[model samples]
Target: MDSILNPSTLKNLVFDLGDVIIPIDLTAPVRNFAMLANLPEDEVWAIWKEHNFINHYETGLLDDAAFRAEVRQLLKNDVWADEVIDTAWNTVLLDLPVERIARIQELKANHRLFLLSNTSPIHIRRVNDVLTQLNLPTLEQLFERVFYSYEVRLAKPSPDIYRHVLTEAGLVAEETAFFDDNAANIQAAAELGIQAVHVQPPMTIIDYVKDL
Candidate 1:
């Protein structure tokens, strides 16, 4: 528990999905793409990063068809199947630890919990499938509201998204706390008078709020 987030004053908790609740392997996609494209891993990674297609897709600027087309074009492999593209794109997602969900369930007793994530439809569907496979509740059942970048057309580190969450949840900035693995997103929330924690590896959400 950070001193800035005095438990006495916080009434709402906003969480980021990737690397916060769900563990992700950022390099997994690169490896997957390399295998799919039959290209060197470094070359595939360079192409992926240079295209910046992910940002557009996550932000809702690109739809599924367009995203797939862009991926094929960027990788210079026009003959790849959609399944191959999807598999490679989704390799970045790993698993959602059950302990993390249990911790969130515990926190529900005290504060209004919400999920704010920068994600695409493909990734979210995969995550939901995992939850179902594990017999855990869907995200909507676990959190009061789940906000996704593709659905909302807004991404974190953007002030508008934070403002939208506060307004939609009917929460006051001063009474809310946000936890994210990204420093930029945390700082954006803090700038709006919300208590923000920069969650890092080896420090899970359970550790952050257990004391509070």
Candidate 2:
């Protein structure tokens, strides 16, 4: 994604929740798991990669109880309660800076902002709690509409989800800008003719749209 922005051409700004609008440390949960299991982060990370079933929860294939059961099994003799497991697992979600909310609101003056994220119910619930703590509006209040993988049953890097957003929002592919932290999602949006911004570290949505 270019550092400059052309608000004239980009009328709609579509954002990803994690690591985009909200700052999240993907490795935080792994580190927490490592602490729980008293193992090295690398070992826990490797195990997590091998047994990544959170996607099932994100795609709504597994309910919260089922997903928690999977986590319990993953930990192997942790015997932690649901609340304990939820707090540990939800460490993947970091704080949502009030500045990010302000930036989004500033852009919302001219752009139709929308949120699309691949997140599970637990994460979403935790996010709202964070928002409440920060005195920020709900995700729906911040954006025109929010599309969650769990609710929509469609994950990103899949053309179908992008198509669904386009159709549902009555947005033209050429006029929309999709900002995400994932390269695959950026490629998917680009392939569908949307302006895709690869929002990597040290560069945020604020930097991506600095010109606007």
Candidate 3:
């Protein structure tokens, strides 16, 4: 599709929810959780490794209840599980830049837009809250449809999730271009023949599409 050229020649645009649509700064909550639990940052991080949850969820191997329970147990703490989850979850919903929101709207006019995220109902609710605060539109109205790991029982970095998006969106691999902050997820999309971009700050998906 010659993504390097102007307009990127994409028929559909699939975006990752976390850092792409919404800005997520993961460090604050991690440090706070560590201090509250009196645990080392690395140990805490290891305990809550996203791959453990994302991999299973993406493959439809784990449901929300089971996933949440596992996350709670991973803390191995005597504290309340809901509180722990809340703290960890809220930390990720750091901020959403208005500039990014406008950019997505701009692209929607020319191409089919879809959100493919490895997230849960709880997180989705929080995201909506943030969106409301920022005066941004909801997922359902913004894109064709929003794909969530908990809602769809599938996540990124797995072929199943990518397959689901492509099949449901009726987009050919070559016609679709994916943008995600996660490298593994982007690589997975690449393997499926979908053009993928790894999104990092100062190098946004919009930057890749500006001239187009």
Candidate 4:
């Protein structure tokens, strides 16, 4: 509801991962692979939509295998199925930067932190690997807890997920601040009375929270 930075001086900070903490390469891997395999981009996206693969995977309804199998089935062409699955599933994941990681570390000193991400098993694994490679502190070091949509069975833009997180943390909406890249999701949280920050690129979330 309120966009004023630090309006509530929150005791808890909730973060969305993809496109917020980690950069996403939405087109490169999927598009390049589709072109190489001679599959139409529209058709591939059709499969993703049909199965609610993106939402389901993000919400934790589908595992990596199910995600892969669903895409393969959509192709209906056995020969190209595996390649299609690989590209569609792996293309969007990218790395986390050290500066951002440090910023998170800085925020830890002031807020009770938590992560709420709509992500799949595959990307979660990759993100953890990136975290390790960067030699950054473990996610546990930065946040009190981590909630994945897949594990929670609730995705963003769904009030239930936010309620669940608030309940789990024993926090009232007025005492918590949520950060996300999607406007719809921020609106959803606002509807539930949680302060929401619309994460924009080139603006550090740390700057959004640091004491003025």
Best-matching candidate per lDDT: 1
Q: Across residues 1-212, which tens digit of lDDT does each residue of candidate 3 receive?
A: 22243245578888888877777776766676677677898887876685476457444577656666765566666455675666575786866777877888898888899999877666677877777877888777788988888667766787998999889878988878888898888788988988887887787767876754
TM-score of each: 0.94, 0.91, 0.81, 0.87
Candidate ranking (TM-score, best to worst):
1, 2, 4, 3
Tens digits of lDDT, candidate 2, 28-117 = 888887788788999877767787687888999898999888877877845878887788878888667778888888988888999999
Q: Each candidate's lDDT (Cα)?
A: 0.89, 0.85, 0.75, 0.75
Report the C-alpha lDDT of model 1 over 1-212, residue by residue, as the tens digit. Answer: 23267889999999999999998998998888788778999997787678888899999999998999998888789998988888888888886799999889989999999999999988888888888899998888999999999888999899999999999889999999999999999988998999999898788888888876
Candidate with the larger lDDT of 1 and 4: 1
For candidate 3, list the clashing residue pairs, or say none.
7-212, 58-155
Q: What is the full ranking by lDDT, best candidate first?
A: 1, 2, 3, 4
Model 3 regions more than 4 Å off: 1-8, 49-84
- The residue-level lDDT of candidate 4 at 112 comes to 83
Model 1 residue runs over 4 Å out of place are 1-3
* Model 4 poorest 10 in a row by lDDT: 1-10
lDDT of 2 at 112: 95
